[model samples]
Target chain A: MANNIYIGVDLGGTSIKVGICDENGKLLHQMEGPTESEGGPEVVIKNIANYVREIVASSSYHWDQVAGIGAGITGFLDIKEGIVKLSGNLGWHDVPVKKMLEAHLGKTVKIDNDANVAALGEAWGGAGAGIPNLVCYTLGTGVGGGIIINSQIYVGSTGVAGELGHIAIVPDLEAIVCGCGQMGCLETVSSATGIIRMAKDAVERGDKTSLALVEHIQAKEVFDAAKQGDEVALRIVNRAAFYLGKSMATLAVVLNPQRFILGGGVSKAGEILFAPAREIFKRFTPEPAQEGVDIVPATLGNDAGVIGAAGLNLHR
Target chain B: MANNIYIGVDLGGTSIKVGICDENGKLLHQMEGPTESEGGPEVVIKNIANYVREIVASSSYHWDQVAGIGAGITGFLDIKEGIVKLSGNLGWHDVPVKKMLEAHLGKTVKIDNDANVAALGEAWGGAGAGIPNLVCYTLGTGVGGGIIINSQIYVGSTGVAGELGHIAIVPDLEAIVCGCGQMGCLETVSSATGIIRMAKDAVERGDKTSLALVEHIQAKEVFDAAKQGDEVALRIVNRAAFYLGKSMATLAVVLNPQRFILGGGVSKAGEILFAPAREIFKRFTPEPAQEGVDIVPATLGNDAGVIGAAGLNLHR
Candidate 1:
């Protein structure tokens, strides 16, 4: 099975990324195309099929050598049945993605949420490689989590496990309404959206800070300003770090994963975010659960999705 | 093999309870003896050995019929090596409990934390019987928790996994210092100590309530007064139930266990605690994760520890 290959599709609202990997997890070929989600689920499905065929056709391996196909889709999913339960980005609801792809490609198809796929990719080849029990946090617009137990994705009974951001760690007094309609979720403070929200609030309150001058503020701009000793920016960054670390401490006692891999846009704030998180994690976690446990930035970055989707054929 | 039996020991500060269970998890014989902890670890170990021997001698089964022995003790433990890391109740530290028991009885011996053993008991034959993935919360003086994944205890990297009560779900503004020294742990607000603390605070604030008349306050009194619609008592019970439900909602997205089993002294409050917790759980949890999950009282009561200890030989 040395030449046995798998096709991975990282499907998003804007584009579809296709990659082919050999049994050893080495990428042999890649391609991309517009998602055309405006054309609805039908068009997106067709584009994914075309990309899979295009990637395999451009590679040296024959179609017969491809073992299976997998897609890292955005939004909620019925993973066992390969249905996209609801995806705001893709404008899909109850779409039978796996069935359509398998029928078109004539290969077995597997699908999972983008977060879980990213985690599988890291566990297969990135930061958490070879560590069976690890959790991945993707801190983009929202905080997404994926739990890998004994080298497999742990989808709770209904295939919706590992929602770390919503762990309600905030007290009622300090809590703001979360997008999920809850109060004081980790996402309300730690995510890129949350960081920007805090920065905007500080500037709106006439706080003394450099952020007020920036016409368009973003999570990155807040981090950049904080690096230059902007007090308000620092406060926002610290608040984000505080809740993020607190959520990790909460998770430390329950899952106790050996490594916590941080990814997505906001995590790139570097040590400005990670330094305080590590310190807070140590302070919050018990001695036993804290020992030998590590917090590290994700290594794969954007490619984690495609690579992780590729691994689904083997790891899932 | 039909007549094969396993010996279980539930060791505590006050007493040591022993039981014999067949392979099918039915208890066949039982007995109890004083812990005699005033004499230290050696005395406790000897008492355990004698109790196991006596239980078998009094039963119909002979020595050959005893397959193994398991002890569930309070405190930190190294489950793999069967070492009681630090048990305040037993006044033990770095005790090689499994090795000593095996050498004394000539049978395979296993040891685990009391909470984990009790969880295994419920998973094996108690409330969560036949359920593979379940989390048990024992809300006694402190909130203790155990995780059962695939019907086995989930000890993390350093044998400290399943510290469910330590999850920092409470925010700082509404937080109190927990016994574990962390601020705003679920145990700080949801445990029996926390309930009593709230009751004390109500009385101190000079709130007009029936609780002020009761000189010696207990958790049961709070529940009794709440049943009678005492304003202060209902407020205290509601706060406790709120945190407990919130913590379960937080855990629901992470582990997605099939059931959340509530046990210990506070759980005895029945629907006054459960009805509100269930409602809060539904409000906080995402629909998919909440679909089949159930919050129910533990059925095994006091026998859970002994039965769960006996099951360690087969399950762990």
Candidate 2:
């Protein structure tokens, strides 16, 4: 039998990425094209099919070797049905994505939210490779998460499993309303937006800090200031890490994944963020759950989405 | 072909319960006998073997009809090795339960902790029947939890997944040390022990409460007092229910189980505990996660242990 290859599509508002992965989830070939989502779902779907074919045509593997196609889309999705129920970024509603893609490419198709797809990518080939159970946290504009169990993405009853940012870790006294309308969610403190908010709040409160000098504050500025031994900036960084570690402690007992993978821009703060999160995880987690469990960074970076989507047909 | 029957053994400190369950996890027959811990591991092993034979012999089912045996023990277990690493309740250390049981029964045998077994029982034939994913909470002396994914008990790495009681939920200022040595754990406020403690604290603090008139405060007294409109007792009950609800909210996002099953003695408080817990769960959970999800009571009660034990081989 010929070796099988998988196709993964990272459908974004501005660009669509397509990658061909070998059985081991190693990217063999890749191509990128504009999404032009404004052209409507039909045009976007055709672009995805064309990109997938182009990737395979450029690769060493034959088209017959392509086992299946999978996509990681941003928005509320009906994963089982492969439908985009609502996508603010794509301006899509009730788009029958799987059926359209499968019709164009004549192959089985699968779809998952971007966070889950990225986590699966890491689990299949990145930081969580060979680890059957793991959790991934993406700390970008908002916190995102994916739960991987038995090497497959675990999308809970409504495909909302691993919504880690909404874990509600902050105490009421310190809590602020989250974008999800919940109070004291993990994202309210641990996300890049949350860190930036804290920095701005500190500056507005007239705390002695270098952040006051920055014209427009960002999470990077906060981390940079903290790295320079700025006390106020350090407090903000600790607060963000504190909630993250606490959320992980809660997840440790609930899911008991073998590893936790941290990704996204906020995680780039390096030891300034990870050190306290790891320490807090250890302090709050019961000793038994913490044994042999580790916290690590996602190794795939931007490629996790494409690689994980390719794994959907195989791992799922 | 003959129908298969499963043998389940619930090993406790003072008693050993044995039952026969059909493929559906329905308990056909059950019997209980002394654990005879003073006689040690060897005697208990023989006793369990005898009970297995006695039940099948007394019933219409033949010995050959029995397919496999499973036991649920209370302890720290090396599940993969089928060893009880430490069991404070059973006074056991490093007992190879699966090996000994397989030796006596001459059949395939499996073992898991009591909490996981009960949750499996509920998932298999009780309230969560036909639900492939769910979380179960046993609010007894200490809150115990089990995660069921794809109809199987998810023990996680090192067999410590689903230890919900130790989830640090209370704010640090108001939190106290838990038996697990963690502060502000969910069990500190939500377990039966937690409820009793709150009542004792209220009385000792010179609060004018009816609980002060009681000779020995139990969880039941607190519930009864609350039913009678005792303000302090109602507050304690509400506090217990509050944490349980909050923990469920956390679980909803993490596991996204189809249902949340509440079992154990404390759950018997019915509407008082359930109403508040459900309301809190709704308040804390994001709309999408809570959609189509429910919090319900466990139906199998004590039988859950034996039935879930019997299901280990089938489910696992």
Which is the leading candidate under lDDT?
2
Consecutive 10-residue window with the lowest summed lDDT within model 1 chain B: B169-178
* TM per candidate, chain B: 0.97, 0.98
What's the residue-level lDDT of A264 in candidate 1? 92
Residue B93 Cα positional deviation in candidate 2, in Å, after optimal superposition: 1.6
**CA lDDT of A210 in candidate 1?**
92
Q: In order, what lDDT does every prediction score?
A: 0.87, 0.93
* Candidate 1 local lDDT, A1-316, one digit each (tens): 4478888899988999999877655667788899999998888898999888887787788899888898999887889999999999988999999999888888999999999998888877788987888989999999998998888888877777888888776677788888887777888899999999998898899999999999999999999999999988998999899878887898889888899999999999999999999999988887767878899999888888998898898978
Using TM-score, give the best candidate's number.
Answer: 2
Per-residue accuracy of model 2 over A25-49 as CA lDDT, tens digit each:
8988888999999899999999999
Residue-by-residue lDDT tens digits, candidate 1, B214-243 = 998999999999999999999999989988
- What local lDDT score does residue A249 receive in model 2, on the 0 to 100 scale? 92
Q: iRMSD (Å) of candidate 1?
A: 1.5
TM-score of chain B of 2: 0.98
TM-score of chain A of 1: 0.96
